[model samples]
Target: MTAILITGGARGIGRATAILAGARGWSVAINYVGNEAAAQETLEAVRAAGGQALALRGDVSVELDVLALFDAVQAAFGGLDGVVVNAGIVAPSMPLAEMELDRLRRMFEVNVLGAYLCARQAARVLSRDRGGRGGSIVLVSSAAARLGSPFEFVDYAGSKAALDTLAIGLSKELAGGGVRVNAVRPGLIETELHASGGEPRRAQRLGAGTPMRRPGRPEEVAEAIVWLLSEAASYTTGAILDVAGGR
Candidate 1:
């Protein structure tokens, strides 16, 4: 059976991906820092989709937690076929000059360092050189990487931009090892991330500026992620797909 693990799987695009992977008959492992209730609900939904799922609690920013998350998945499902590094956080909009060190540290810790740690584990589990079967690694980035949300969180944008480079460099490094690395940059998507940024209706208000004239649904992003995980994208790697609908 195909087994996949997703960080921040309790909500937003991560939740949608977990549920959809379940529907596709993949054993899903969900990692959530807090909100056990939401994680349980997501686990139940995955089961409803006819797939086995385990909701594990851990903060990806912490090395011990990251280790525990991957350990739990390996023990439960034997090994992983794919991993989605999606656990991240957003602070209220603030210019780089106004942002405090703590905010930047937290953002880079969870978004950049956390992703690096998860990718490292995925590499170990999915590398042919390591005596394991190879698999896919998908990094959930943001359009803000390029757009650079001025007057908002430029730090977040900078961090995701770093992730884009990680995808490209890591993909090239692992291609011969049977592991494919790629990323999806979602635009103004309708996710709770906006509210966390202190703008709950930001997607609705700003989506009209895009050519699509609306924000994307979490499911839309999930589709791209799952496809990347599937064999259909066998020839694709190091790709940073933009799902922003032409912003």
Candidate 2:
């Protein structure tokens, strides 16, 4: 059976992907920083959807924690077949000039650094030269990366842009090793991430302006992500797919 590890798998796009993967009979290892309750709920939901589940608590920003997360997945699932670099954070809307050092530091630390850490570990374990079966690595970026998210969290936009570059470079780096790397850029998704950014209805408010005239659902993005993780995208690599509504 396919075995996958998804960082921040407790909620939003991560949670939706876990449940969908479950429905496909894949073994899923979910990593969450806090909210064990949400993780446990997702665990049950995955099982209910007919897949095995494991909830691991870890902070992606911490190297030790990230190491343990991969280790735990290996122990629990025997080996990993895919990884979703999805754990990230967003702060309140603000111009670049007004942004505080601590906020910028934390933003990059978790978004960029944490993503690199996860991608690094994924490469180590998924590379064929590393004595493991090759697999897929999917990074969850954002449309903000392209839009620049002007006047609202440019730091977050910059951080996500890093993921886009990571996906491109890492895909080529691992292509000969039998591994595939790609990223998804979701736009105006209705999720708790916006509330965390201090704009609870940000998606809904701005979604109307998109060509699709609506915000995307987590499940919608999950479909694209899970496809990249599946054999359907067997020959696809170094691709950045936009799940945004043509914004």
Candidate 3:
């Protein structure tokens, strides 16, 4: 069976992708830093969708945690066929100058360094040169990577921009090995992340501003990620798909 790992699978895009991928017959490993309740619910949803699911608690930013998480998934599933680098966080809304050092460090630690570590591990196990069948790696970036997020989250935006670069570079480095690396940039999606950003109503406030007249749903972004994780996108790689409804 095809086995895949999804970081930050407790809620939002990660949760949606886990459920969708499960329904598609992929065994799933969900990595969450906290929120065991949400993660448990997501685990059940994956099972309900008809796939074996494992929920592992770990901070993706820490090397030991990332290693343990992947190790646990490898032990449970035997091998990995795909991975979703979706684990990330944002601080309360503020200007760059007003943001604290801890906030910036934590932001890059998880959003940038954490993603880098996860991708590196995925490449190690999924590369054909490493004696394993190749697989796909999908990084969940944000539209902020392009728009810069201005006064709200320049640090977060910068981290995601780094993710885009990593995806593009890794795609070329791994294409010959049969592994696909791509990214999905979600716009104003209706997810709980807004609350953490100190603007729970942000999506609602910005919905009409987008051409679609509505903020996107997590499921919409998941659809793009699911496609990238599937054989249907066999010829596609290094693509940064925007799930942003023309925002």
Per-residue alpha-carbon lDDT of candidate 3 for residues 80-140, written as tens digits (9 for 90 to 100): 8999999999888888999889989999999999999999999988899897689899999
Candidate 1 residue-wise lDDT at 200: 98
List clashing residue pairs in candidate 3: none
Q: lDDT: which is higher, 1 or 2? A: 2
Per-residue lDDT of candidate 1, residues 5-37 (tens digit) = 999999999999999999999999999988999
Where does candidate 1 stray beyond 4 Å?
none
**What clash count does candidate 3 reach?**
0
Point to the candidate with the largest TM-score.
Answer: 2
TM-score of each: 0.99, 0.99, 0.99
RMSD of each: 0.7, 0.5, 0.7
Task: For residue 195, give model 2's deviation from the true position in Å.
Answer: 0.4
Give the alpha carbon lDDT tens digit for every residue of 176-217 in model 2: 999999999999999999998899999999999999999999
Most lDDT-accurate candidate:
2
In model 3, the Cα lDDT at residue 247 comes to: 86
